[model samples]
Target: MLKVHEIFSSIQGESSHAGWPCSFLRLSGCNLACSWCDTLHAGDSFAGMSVADAAAALAALGLPLVEITGGEPLLAPETPHLVTTLADAGCTVLVETNGSLDISRLDPRAVAVMDVKCPGSGMEGRNDYANLDRLRPRDEVKFVLVDRADYDFAREIAARVWTRQMVHFSPVPGRLDAAELAAWMVADRVRARLSLQLHKYIWSPDARGV
Candidate 1:
């Protein structure tokens, strides 16, 4: 069984799949308390359901793409099974994980969008750098930058590790301006994409269920 916070259909808000209709299964609970986390409301409250039920819920949404996210989905032991279930059922699955946990165990068929916590997030120490070695070309590395220092930090990592996979640098909403971040990326000629939180623009930043 898995502890589920909410299941809803929305546009893929980030990463290479942005703007596509997708189903999101947000699981509850997290191990790290990042300073700028937007989903604090999902911390503890949840409803438990078997993997079969959760798969049914997402499949009912009729979207070909699905993302299993969380307060930190990797914290839940059943997540790998859930990912496999969804993929076997013919849905494209994405797991958005806080980079602290080991992602090597995830179903190879599901794309893993791993977030390497930047210094600005206040949880940088929690990042498992070993996860970098485990990333497949289809996976993504994300850095949510809050300032220039964070950008530099992400650039350094991308320089050393990024190859066929995409490296995304997203400015923390309201903290760093998107245009400024884009300029810095261009000036440095960094091999990374600028990701904006699309749902926040389509709906209010705090709007629920997209």
Candidate 2:
């Protein structure tokens, strides 16, 4: 069994799959605390359930996609097994993780939306640089910008380290404005696609389980 916060259905709010209807299996616990973390409660264990139970909950939703997010999903030792179980249930799994963890052990079939923390996050030094080498073209890398400095930092990183096809640049909700980030991306000619937390805008900003 895995520590779990909640399981619900919602639209993909970040990464390349944004706007797609998906079943969310939010696992509990994280190794880092970013300043802009919206799901602080997710890291605090509210319940526990097995992978099969999680898959069954998602199957009941009848969604084609299942997003396993956190408080860093990698904190769960059984994450890879959960991904396989979800896939076997015919759900396209997407794992959203902080880049600090080693995703090398995860199933390559799952779409990884790894978050690369910026200076504003205070945990930027914790980013696992080696994860970049494990990325496939189908996978995505996300950088959350809290200010212009974060944007510049992300741009530099993208130019030097990341050359993935599906790179995403997202402004920290309520910190940096999306329009400003989009303008910066255009002016700098950055290669990453701009990502907006669409669900936040669609629903209450404080809403849980999407």
Candidate 3:
């Protein structure tokens, strides 16, 4: 059984896939609590269900792309099984996880968007730096920048990490302005793509499920 928080259809909001319509499977629980996290709702008690049941619910959505996000999806021991089951059901599974978890155990077919916490996030030290070697080109590494310090830190990591093609940077939802972050990227000549929460601009910033 998987501890699922919610299963709903929404656009991919925070990665290169942003603005694309996708179904989201938000699981419950997390191993780390970052200061700027917006999905506190996902941290509550989860409703358990079998992998088959989860896949069936996803099949009913009829969407090709499915994101397995969470308070931290990798914390769930059943995550790899869930990813495989969803893939078997013809869903393109994407798992969004904080970089602290061991993703080598996850399904290789699933696209992983691993968040590498920056200094401003307070949980920066918890990042599993070795995960960089484990990421495939299909996977993405995301940095949620809160300020200049975070931006500089992310830039430094992006330079050292061999996965430059998979790098992404996005401002914290309400902390930094998008234009400012974009300009910084240009000035620094950062090799990462800049992203914004497209769903927030489309709907209310706080709206649940697109």
Candidate 4:
């Protein structure tokens, strides 16, 4: 069984999957403490669920897409098996992982939306650079930028490993202006998708289940 924070159906908020109808399984606990964490309330366990039960719950939501997110979902030992099970069942699985852990273990059929923490997140040093070599044709890399320095950091990484189709550049809400981010991307000709938190804009930013 894995520690579960919450499970809900919502629009895919971030990444290239944005706006797609998606079910979420947010696991509890994290290995790193980001300064601008939005889901601090999810850090504690809400319940415990087995891998099969969790997969059934997501499938019952009747969405084409499903995400296994965190509080660092990779921290759960059962997650890789869960991914494999879901993929075998013909469900589209998206593993939203903080890039501090080994993502190379996930099934090839599943898409891994890996978050590469920026300097503003205060967890930059924890990034697993080796994961860059592990990215597949279908996987995505994300950078949640907070300031100009963070933008520069993201740009450099994008240049070095800009092979994928979906390099997401998202700004921290109430911190960095989206317009500024758009301008910077345009000015520098940076190749990445500008991802705004769609769920936050659709509902209250503080809302638990989208």
Candidate 5:
């Protein structure tokens, strides 16, 4: 059983899949505490459900895409089975993970959206850089920037470690301006794409369940 927080259908908020209709299974608990984390409530309060039950719930939504996000879904031992179950149910699965944990064990059919923690997030040291080598061509690496330093850090990583996979640079809402982040991306000529949380823009920033 997984510690299930909330399951809902919403627009793909961030990633190469952004703007698509997606069902989200927000699992509970996180090992790292990022300063800018917007889903803190997801970590604690949750209902325990088996992988089959979770898959059935998402299948009922009839969305073709599903994102298994967390408070760090990787923190759960059954996550791999949950992901596999979802994939077997014919959902194009996406798993958003903090890069602190090894992602190699996740089902190959699911696209991995891994985050490389920036210094401003206060969890940079926890990043498992080895995850870079494990990223598949369809996988994505993400960095949430809070300031110029964070952008520079992301740039440096992009220069050294970037592969065929898409890299995403996201501005920390309220801390870094999206326009300023775009300018940095242009001036630096980084290969990454700018990732905005489309759900936040479409609805209220604080709104949950899309």
Candidate 6:
């Protein structure tokens, strides 16, 4: 069984798949506590459901795009199974992971959008660098920045990976100005795409179920 936080249809808010109509299955719990975490409430509550049931419900959403996200979905033992099940059902599955866990075990049909936490998150040490080798051509790397220090850190990583796959640099809205980050990227010619949380702009940042 999996402890699921919510399953709802919403526009893909981040990553290369942003703006697509997608269904989200947010699992509960996380191993890392990033300082700027927006979904702390996910760990505070959850409802247990079997993997089959979870996949079934998501398929019923009828959206071709489905994402298995979380308070860190990779933390759940059932996540890989849930992802594979959905992929088998012909859904273009995207798994959003926090870069602390092993991602190679997931089904090849599913794409992974792995977040390489920046120093501002205070969880950089939790990163498993080995996961970098596991990223597929279709996979994506994400860095959520809050300060210049975070931006510098992400810049180094993006230089190495951006040429091989998709890399996104997103600023923590209140802490770092997007325009400022954009200017820095322009000056440095950073090899990454500036990602804004599109859902936050479409609705309240705190709103759930999109």
In candidate 2, how many Å is residue 11 off? Answer: 1.3
Candidate 6 deviant stretches above 4 angstroms: none
Candidate 6 residue lDDT tens string, 1-210: 798899999999999899999999998999999999999989858999999999889989999999998898988888888888888889999999999999998999999999998999999999998999999989999999999999999999778788898999999989999999999999998889999999999999999998
Query: Candidates' TM-scores?
Result: 0.98, 0.96, 0.96, 0.98, 0.98, 0.98
What order do candidates take by lDDT, descending? 1, 6, 5, 4, 3, 2
List the pairs of residues colliding in candidate 6.
none
User: How does candidate 1 fare on TM-score?
Assistant: 0.98
Model 2 lDDT per residue over 1-210, tens place: 789888899888888778899999888888998998888987677688887777788899999998999888988888899898888877788999899988887787899888889999999999998988888667788898899999988888777545544888989877899999999889878888998889989999998878
How many steric overlaps does candidate 4 have? 0
Tens digit per residue, CA lDDT, model 1, 88-181: 9888899999999999989999899999999999999999999999998789999999999999999998876666788999998989999999
lDDT of 4 by residue, 6-89 (tens): 999999998788999999999989999998998788798669889989888888989879899989989999999999998998
**Candidate 5 residue runs with Cα over 4 Å from true position:** none
Q: Assess each prediction's global lDDT (C-alpha) against the native.
A: 0.93, 0.86, 0.86, 0.91, 0.92, 0.92
What local lDDT score does residue 205 receive in model 6, on the 0 to 100 scale? 95
Instruction: Please list the residue runs of candidate 3 whose C-alpha ends up more than 4 Å from where it truly belongs after superposition.
Output: 162-164
lDDT of 3 by residue, 1-210 (tens): 789888999878877788778988889998888989888887886899888898889889888999999989888888899999888777788999999988898888889999999989899999999998888768888999999999989999887663445688889877888899999989977788888878888889777766
Identify the candidate with maximal lDDT: 1
- Candidate 3's C-alpha lDDT? 0.86
Question: Every model's Cα RMSD, please?
Answer: 0.7, 1.2, 1.3, 0.9, 0.8, 0.7
Task: Supply the TM-score for candidate 3.
Answer: 0.96
Error of 4 at 124 (Å): 0.7
Point out the higher-scoring one by lDDT: 1 or 4. Answer: 1
Tell me which of candidates 2 and 4 scores higher on lDDT. 4
